[model samples]
Target chain A: MRLPYLLAGLSVAAVYLVLLHVGEGRQREAEEHAKQGHVTASYAQLGKAYALYHEGHWPLLDTRNRHFAYDLGIVPKGYAIKQEMEKDHAPQAVLFGKLGRHAALSLVPLVDFRNYFYLGFAVTTEEEGLALAKALRSGAALDRDIKVAQGTGTLGSSTLYRLHDDIVETLVMDGVLARQDLTLPGRIPVIVERPRDGYAWVVFLDMHVEHLRYPGPFPLTSKFVDTLESDAL
Target chain B: MLHERYDWLDQARGFVVLLLIVSMPTSEYAGDLLTGDPVLGPPMLNHGYEYFDGDPAITTFIDSGQALFLLVMGFVGYTAFTSRLRKRGKGAAFWYCARRVGVLYALASIDCVLLELATSGKPKWGDFFYNGTFAMIALGTLCAFLSIVVIPNADRRMLFSVGLIMLHSLLYAFPFFDHHTWYDNILALPKFPFGTLGMCAMAIAGSSFGQWHAMDPDNPRTGFRKRIVPVSTAAFVAAYCMDWVQPAQHHDSNAAMLLQAMYIGGFMLMIFFAFGEVGFRFPLLSSLGRNLLLMFALGGLFIGIYLDCFPKEFLLQSPYLALLLGGLAPIVILSCVAVFLDRRGIMVRA
Candidate 1:
């Protein structure tokens, strides 16, 4: 009677030990897979934007001294408004805004841990935007060490690419275009405004990407475009 | 006609009743757990799964005191099956047992009414009081019927039964004075112990009748074996059927009412079979059964501590697993101790 009881006890203990070990192994594997996927996707998008800037046609801006001004539309004075855009234009602005927001939002969360930055600019001609878009698609114009990927979306027929952090910063500081808000870190201001009925010229401190629509004039300095090409080599 | 020999039918009936009483607590606990509510009072901890979260009124009124009664009656039945005496009258011991249980029922019912009044017409009154009263009455009724049928030599047993009642009443009045104060938090604990003592006395009285049945020449094994199968089967079937009825609508639903009836019936049957089969040999469990007052007080205290302090996640997450281990752990430990004690022939007697 005693021997049978002792045997039963030992068998139960062995079964318990085996179950604990198997459960722990499965938990570790799940954690590792989730972390690796997040990092890889972020790095790929940055590389594409850098390539487009190197080869695209840059827009020239109409300026007063160093500052370029672009008019969006007229607003009625003394009216308290919840949204900046008017009703007819609100839908178009929202669609375009989301594209730009997505690019900015994605890079924002990763900014502290990795090297990433946001670049905003506008161009005058569809041809110039297409030229910039094609250049972004080409790998040769981007830095040898960095990889490039680009995305295009319509916001009332304008396009933008989220650029790689290092490339965007290098072009802005090298004096390719006259700079505003230079005191702030990681702030590269490019004002895109509509002049008359024709189109808007967007100015960039660096070369533009063809995949993005150049709806108007862009204020880009020749020197910044030169540095981008030079950096690619 | 007075029989010089014991009649197995009487012994078997007492055994069935005892088993019914012993197993009542498990069913009550299971029912509360299934409904996701406490069957007793407020749980010791926040978000505790030990007690059902639903209205305690029904549980208190119907389940708790009833379970206690079943537990007590089960012990008494066991004691009656074990005693050695001649079966002078077939129905006398059974009537004696019934009367003794009736006393307990009356006391418990009054306790229930007092509790209900104290709580002031709350729905919880039903759970707290009525259920308890029902349990007492049901067990008392069953014992009354069984004692009248089986045990004739119950006069001496009646004295012990009265003693058991007094002891229980005393415990209820002064719980702190009990030897195991740590476990006697509930007012019911003292009553339960006394009930167990009464059962032992009843069993001792019933045993004398059992001896006569064993000696009867017309049918020796007929009384014990014949009764065991049907009674056990009836208990199993009744308990199974009762499992389907929802307790919440026990008052409204005829099915629920029927289920409770069956449960009581089934319990009594199981007790009868268990004692007849054991033949007073399992003195340890019998002793435990006999000392209902002490065992219940201590058991309740231990159960309270387990529910209050033991981790709920470990016990309730998988109830089947928890129950399997919970039931087995104690038995194994006891068996080991029993083995050690048995080697020295130092049996623990009630």
Candidate 2:
């Protein structure tokens, strides 16, 4: 009896490995195409990767129950509306005692991601955002105490601010910071300054590269806003 | 014959629960207190455990005490379930298991709510399922009930366990959605690597071993050595091999559950063979083993209250003092409760 069960398990495991290898192969191809600037091909490969690897809707049993779309994928209208509302206001100051108890500090109400690149949003007044951005840009030249390299490329409507700090560098070196996705390559810190709708929204990129470099093809644009606004409707 | 209590099993469970009780406070407070100090931190905190994610190197069976508990429960719980089924019939057995699940669920919910209130001054309804150990146990028990009702045979239960784990392994391969925020990984929210299934698999697989012991109650140790030992060893090796293909993180993958179940099985086997008599003499172990759910729930509640009242800042002032008050104090208090309950012939099963 054990022998038969073992044989069956081995068979299933072999199939699982084959599927895994094929899925991973497609995923790698997708990444390669993405790097090569083949957006359509990359996306096509990604879809194939999903079909092979993901047991979407549990097709094996034709179970009516659907595999849950992860929280990051589904952007509910209410949450988007909340993000829009929060965009006009500063982040609610959490009490010191409540800091480590919950994930409130790490919770970004609005986010968008494509491949390895992630864009996170925080609410700040327009004046504060501009003043801070301006101060950072100016402070790079004057302030020897801090180092900030302004990136030449633009991230949608925002100006890319590449921050170089010893603490972050040490953290990256020591591998102290955890990546959002385990599959992502190491860790790096980058910040973007986006001023929009009478608010200086501090747009943060969720990149986990080895070193700070301009992430390729910033996709969060007017379309992102349009999508959110329309979804809110 | 199957209804007979196993002191060694209870002692092993007591040991696991003790680890759970200590590790929680130690990780929460001591990690912060002694993190950067050159002399006090490194090796002392090196073996310290957590309910980890993603990182394969740090993710071990040792990290998840919850998995250990489930493994033990898988044995005794299944044996007890079978005993009840034989004596009282299906309805009684199902009711017995259902009531246990309900109690566990209630305790887990209360623990989450109390901790939330302690920290944030308000209870977040969403966080009620955040307590991983309790949630896993409750759900695992429910799954065990279902599995027993549907596939009671030990051989089939083992097959079901293997199949579920295989499915679980495949499920994680396509986590296409980027978890960019902390909320994305929240247990309350729908996410990949639903650990309840993993726990269920662990319980079912565990019950297979329990069945072996039951088959030869007169010579259970011989049966354990002949059957459970080799099988567990093979499963452990298999799980380790599969883990290389995909890193096994606790509650994140079914492979991790298999690894942990084997790990705990091996540990319990060690206790059974060598220190079986030692465990039999330990009344506190017996008490803790019997009142597993009650102790765990109360321990968690006490930890929450202690953290809230004392706070980390106060604890940090004198790290050694904090270690004593924050860590040892709760264990001592819990031991007293366990002992008192034991002496009074009280056993809170759920």
Candidate 3:
């Protein structure tokens, strides 16, 4: 009979309506903050430094300075980049996290919305940041994407490192070891770079995530790359 | 002889296979969560589109696919068992499947062990005996085989399915399941496969569907839309609206299971009817469905093999292009393999 199906349908509908009401506020807040102006504003106070690397390695840039053609989808609050750091670091957990280790890591979700980019910074005691840098230089767990080989970038010795078949690339600065795990899976074309200083960065482009399952050529490609290039922290 | 090409089943399975393959790169199994022991095999190992970074839509979709897989498993299992019963008799079918399920269990155990060795240097006892989907499949088959053979009455079988799931649902009411108690790991042993009442319930529902399909004189193709469209639409709407479930983040939660059923059931009805005309028109998906196990294994290895062997730096320059290609890698390889297997009549049922 249709009884089981009907009851299931009604129960499901009722439950969902209640849940939608509860989550509406969070959804609206996420949409409001996701505005392009709100996102780029985070770097406004930092002056032009956020845009240029080492005073002038790359020119200052602004991205998505306008509308989000189709709002991708709201990511639940406080969801971390554990997928990148945790899964990637599972093999190296012994050497990475605890107090006296190779490097201390800080993974940040750029905006509260968390669709686009996740930034990772590894700070080491003393010159160990450089030591960690050297270890990264070894390319321990990553594969080199030969299509865009080292020194292929317009910038200083810029190279790309990726796990095979992966979309996100470790955009190694001057060939410094980039964070292998600082990735936004499914959203490729994002950059994971480490500059001359001990600081390492992950600039994820939300365009890939937002535009997937929709239309062609993925608009905003240039905007994302420019933002990453400008903010190659 | 292979069952007259059940176009819907083939497409359904191919769809499941496609979902699994795509979800792999996008989702990473929670190894940290898998540590110690788990009740439902590390939250289904599917975090969804953002590499398990909590993409709600994709996560729900994946969950529904998995649940439908269980349902299909029961339907197909019952169909196969009944067909075999006519040829081999009821007792023979029963024992034969017992042995068959044993083999499946052995393979599942080996898979778990190998996965552990691959990811973590050391393999645990649980890896060999209990882990991931193998146990779920093997153990679930055994449970269904027993239920079908013993409960001959259809009405009773339906009640049994409902009762079994309700009993399973009680495990959650216990705060013990929620925490990291020492016993939680110990309890996970029995929990493999038939341990979760929800899983058993799903299998029963599937078997019932299969039984119905076999007996019904009405053309399934024509009757499908009339019977399924409304139910499926309702299920989907209800499932999409599910927010309290946090379906993606917590795999073992009941919400995840319910969402999976609704999504899978609804999507399946829509897809089976919509793509029926065109889906099988492509030879690759059909044959891949036939030789699914092999293609699935091959797909899982697509990335791993690439990581170990090739080193392409150019992919990063154009991430979207790389992503587009990455999605295509499995399809291309599967198509090639499907073509090879289809031509040769090679099929791996398990």
For candidate 1, write residues A1-233 as lDDT tens digits. 99997898678546633542443244234223222322322322232333356453222211121112111121111111133445444322232223312421111122121121112232223333333434444432321222222222111122332232343343345442345443322222232222223322222333221111223223233333332223221
Q: Candidate 3: where is the Cα deviation over 4 Å?
A: A1-233, B28-46, B49-58, B115-121, B153-159, B179-196, B221-250, B253-255, B273-280, B301-303, B307-314
Ranking by TM-score: 2, 3, 1
lDDT of 2 at B177: 26
Tens digits of lDDT, candidate 3, B285-308: 567677665666566656555533
Top model number, DockQ: 2
lDDT of 3 by residue, A33-87 (tens): 2333333333221222322433322111112221111112211222122323455
Error of 1 at B1 (Å): 21
Worst window of 10 by summed lDDT in candidate 1 chain B: B180-189
Better of 1 and 2 by TM-score: 2
CAPRI-style docking class of model 3 based on DockQ: incorrect
What would the TM-score be for candidate 1 when compared with the true structure? 0.27
Which tens-of-lDDT digit does each residue in B1-350 have in candidate 1?
33232222334322332333333334334424433443322222112222343221232223323332443344334434333123534455555555555655545544465544666753343433234434334444455345434544433333333334333323323222222221112222222333333333233323322333343457644533454234325434643443342222222212222223333433443454455557644434433333333333334334433444434445556766555544344334334443455456553222
**Model 2 segments beyond 4 Å from truth?**
A1-10, A23-233, B30-54, B113-132, B176-190, B251-254, B277-281, B307-323
Which should have the higher TM-score, number 2 or number 3?
2
Error of 3 at A140 (Å): 46
